[model samples]
Target: MSEMIDENAGGRVVVVGAGPTGLLLAGDLAEAGVPVTLVERRHAGRSNLSRALVVHATTLEAFDARGIADDLIAKGAPVQALRLFDTAVVDVSELPTPYPYLLVVPQYETEAVLQARLDRLGVVTRHETEVVGLRQDADGVALTVRDADGTREERAAYVVGTDGHDSSIRRLLGVEFPGHTVVASVMLVDAVLADPPSLRIATNTDGDKFAFVAPFKDGYHRIIAWDQSHPKAESEPVDLDEVRAVLHATLGTDFGMGEPRWSSRFHSDERQAEHYRAGRVFLAGDAAHTHSPAGGQGMNTGLLDAANLSWKLAAVLRGRAGDALLDTYESERYPVGTAVIKGSGRLLRAAQIKATPARKLRNLAMHFALQRPLVNRRIGFALSGLWVRYAAPAGAHELTGHRAGDVPLTGSPSRLFEALRGGGFVLLAPTELHEPAAEAGVRTAVPADGGPVRLIRPDGYIAWAADTPGAEEVALAIRASGA
Candidate 1:
């Protein structure tokens, strides 16, 4: 990483927060030979307090494009279906992607994979360097960073804030984080179980208490419990006794919860930043949106945000895309963020229904809805992020803006994703078609279908397609991608 540092510091981009989102974005930029500096406030170490635990299909596709998804799948537990209330389940086995289920790995493991990718690219992360404030004009962004050494200025062509919920960069940019608390004083505990539940997931409620238990990849369990009757502040201490009480009250047993390693009290909120971009600065991950942990979508959403933005940033920086390409990041991600917040909020509200009759009605309705394979499949698609697709422009091809499934490429016998090894677009065209500009960051491969031509973005979305694609279609897609 030291040797790979950019010679022209002023021309490089700086990413705040060395979390999963920042690391992935930095790796994407660096892999494309774009100068990037990743800054973090904490020393690098895997956290025992694993927050996000489920890696969905969309995220797996993103990782697979980087050639690390299979390795990550090897290191985690796979849950084929997510058990909702006793009557319903989100069967991910019906998903359209190769990864038809969720990988139950801790957040730390995700971070480690990304960190390794960054290291391989020689993109060193400057830890303990926190962005205190920032100011930007026509030229670049000047950050007020503080570390052990003291405060100093660091400049970059553009800055991205992937910092968590309470992001310093978001505040410095004067963005409004608008939303309300979904679950107050929710207790979280990571513990070993001498007598574990027969099921990998257990969720139930009794009277005013609610409890959920899901096993980690390591066989340990993470328990989340909340009690409407027992009001407490988020800072209040959480203990094994309190956990046992809540679990017994809600789930009829504690599953022999003992030997706690990490415990805390937190509140889930349904909120999103009013703006993801402000001039030259931008936000991704928790810095942009957050919501109830009911659907386990925060991390997945953030990672997708990074994947969408990184390519545009790289394209803009490399002079392959225009400045307008950056605008699409917010335009695309903001709606996805809004959808996540709404979906998670719905789940939280259903779980928090205090009245017994209301809970019964909700359960019955959900069960009836999930009774059909089509409905269940739709639910799986949404939770697993496979449901996400961009809006198609008028008079565009049918597949335009649709999520590009991994299709077998011509000649090489590899898939379209394999051609993305260099972090650029992959244009599939017949030998007769001509697209000279496609050579730069665009891999010209034979179409899997042996059909018409297609332009796939780095993040695996079809931008343009035609029966007889030429330089005009390729050029239009590149310009649309801001490449």
Candidate 2:
């Protein structure tokens, strides 16, 4: 095998799997002036089939930081609330953010947007390429890749696997993916429905069966249904008849479904890597974790994983941060992945209740709990990903490690997320502190009247904040964040 060495290999990143996670992460690195190479096993063509259909509010906010949220929002339908069973509803209209609803776009559409960004940034993706082997040393990583031409070895300072559940990189690293199957023989289909449900998202269960239906921008509906009484093997073929039967049984009508474009039968497993990082190699998206599709958190969680890791990788490679900054990627994201796994599993188990009395009780409890405003808002925030926060140190500010929402600012950028477009820390402080903040290697903005001084990370989280503006403290915080 021939060895291909990049002149800038010491500062380069090799990303495996050109899915949304890898695409977004590569784009972020390229935008930040870090060299990135994206590799994928699939041929270079956009496919219509997709398993993920929901984009949560927090993910949209992340896209907004990259200046691509508007483009993606234009390609999907937004649902203000999600209906679970006949009685419970989780409304997201009152969330304190620009995007207060869930965008129901196909996974392919999201991938297309990210791919466009990567193309604009001149980041070429190597398709029809697969990773056959991996090795890492103290200095960098070496990967064995196979393409149509031949097999070769490529080197990079770091390697990230955004590959799906059966990640070759994870296997090569011998990382343990521990979890069990949540449900078997789940049916997924994309079809044109003659009559669609009035609700933007329709989901319910009738004890033995459960189904979920959401609209696509192209007049098709993505349906996921399961029948506990008639479990089928993953190899069994799923046709329109079987899908129609389950939808009819669970949703009370198939909505005259016909002309299926895609269908499949698969099992849902709740698995997470024992560790996200192994020396110079890391895992993100489905490579790091996989969970039931109850709350549609799989892809959203993966995209967020890429967002969390991209900036850190860029910072370290660019010499703006030390290697320890890379460790935060796993510490900050592992707990979120674990919580999503458990949360989605709970939703799946709740929907799978098979007894009449138990189902009634489950629905009643959900309905009663959702009626309270506090509980309703909390559920909305959790599902939309706004409730996520990293662990903060004892003496840190209250806002530290929390997401910095799109608050108005008295400056040229005029918003917190807009300032993040430059891919650096942003300090929202008093006018008198602007020069000092700028000297600390961060963009400075004047906050609206009476707002506290804050240092926002490139990914839109509050790295540090203070009610009382102190130049020393501000500079120290920015330095501490490895800016």
Candidate 3:
């Protein structure tokens, strides 16, 4: 038996997998004064071969809450429109948020920003340590992990597996990940294109092939190409010639692509765990759900999952809320995961239509729908994750569960997201209500326009709101939120 290390002194959280999801969750917890240990299987260094390539508007807003959005935005190109097929487009320029476009950057860049935050928070990340076994009881969870030295037991009050699709924590928890593979033998590569496409994001599909190209800040372009007619096994080696052939077939040119930095082949799966939580153990990111790469939502969704669960976990461990508050994590995120799976699956199926007539009809239908401003905005919002809203309790205000965008405030932190940087809730209300709101363990800010008193959760979602809220009524809502 491996020796056990009892580190559960102060409700320590052990976050498995140091990917963006795990890193963000750990940082959030640490920022909230929660002791968190981040463990990763990989060695102590960042990998350049990151799969996720775009950060959506919602994710940027989440980063803004942590004061890191500007750093990440400076590292990527802002794509205002996403082009599908030849005619259909999802325009995101008109979104109401401060960041209205998708920031196209490598996943490593995103991870770097989160890792830096973790470092500043004094959170320790144990790389090269892999979770091999897990067992949870009513009080806490025991994780068996292995590193170069040997296997040992690590204890934590709560465990979150932000590890990718094949999560060790989820597997040890005996959870069921039931879903199907959506795309097979998809080839991905990062290379320098001698003749780059004019569009920031260039994507097109012939009847038999599909290709997408988006640039990186370092001058390399990330390319994803699929040839349905000649489906290669994922184990087959992908070369520049094969990539060029598919690009040429779909985009009518290879754009002088060469000097491949990295290349790989893999299948995309649409899967979600049966439940995100089992006792003291929980799952986030790809461990909880995964879907097609269409819409660049995979990383974005996982980041949001971390954002939603972190504050709740902090509140529970800090004794501000009851354990039942933790249950809402899965309840709120599962539906969003399901929606992404279905929506992305529809996109992949549409893009994979092999028949010329079917392809033409798909393009025509999409083009027509996108031409309508409402339809275009809806699709853009969905893709950017700005349309996500949790279910509000009965009798709750209309704005409950909806995201509180960077609304202007009358206080020092002049925006709602800025107010969230203290790792607590914010009550935006009339100046008279500030006194009562302060007692609820939340920062108080007067709304610039003098609207209804709205209580915003740490994650930027509206928790409670009322046009005419008494002090006691506001206090009750805050206490219910465990703040």
Clashing residue pairs, backbone N/CA/C < 3 A, model 2: none
Candidate 2: tens digits of C-alpha lDDT, residues 1-483: 012223364889999999989999988888877888999998999966588899999999999998999999999999998778776888889998899998999899999999999989898999999999999899998899999999999889999999899999999999999999888888989889899988778899886788999998889999998887889888998867877888888778999898778888888899999999999999999999999998899999999999899889877876668999899999999999999999998888888787888888988898899888899998898899999998887988898999989978875788888888847778888878777677765788887755778888888888888899677777777778866
Q: What local lDDT score does residue 39 receive in model 3, on the 0 to 100 scale?
A: 92
lDDT of 1 by residue, 1-483 (tens): 111334375558889998889989999888877788899898766666577878888999999999888778877888786557655666678678888987878788898898888877788888878888799988899999898899998889999999999999999999999998877888888888877766667777664777888778787888888887876887789867878998887777888888778888888888899999999999999999999887789899999999999888877776666788889899999999999999988777778787878888877887888878999988888888888889877998888888888888767847877777657777778755445544443567877678667778889998887776667666766666554
Candidate 3: residue 360 Cα off by (Å): 1.1
In order, what lDDT does every prediction score? 0.82, 0.87, 0.88
Name the regions of candidate 1 deviating beyond 4 angstroms. 1-9, 434-441
RMSD of each: 2.5, 3.2, 3.4
Single out the weakest 10-residue window by summed lDDT for candidate 2. Answer: 1-10
- CA shift at 445, candidate 1, in angstroms? 2.0
Q: What TM-score do all the candidates reach, one by one? A: 0.94, 0.96, 0.97
Q: What's the distance in Å from true for residue 453, model 1? A: 1.9
Clashes in each model (backbone N, CA, C under 3 Å)? Answer: 3, 0, 0
Point out the higher-scoring one by TM-score: 1 or 3: 3
Worst 10 contiguous positions by lDDT, candidate 1 = 1-10
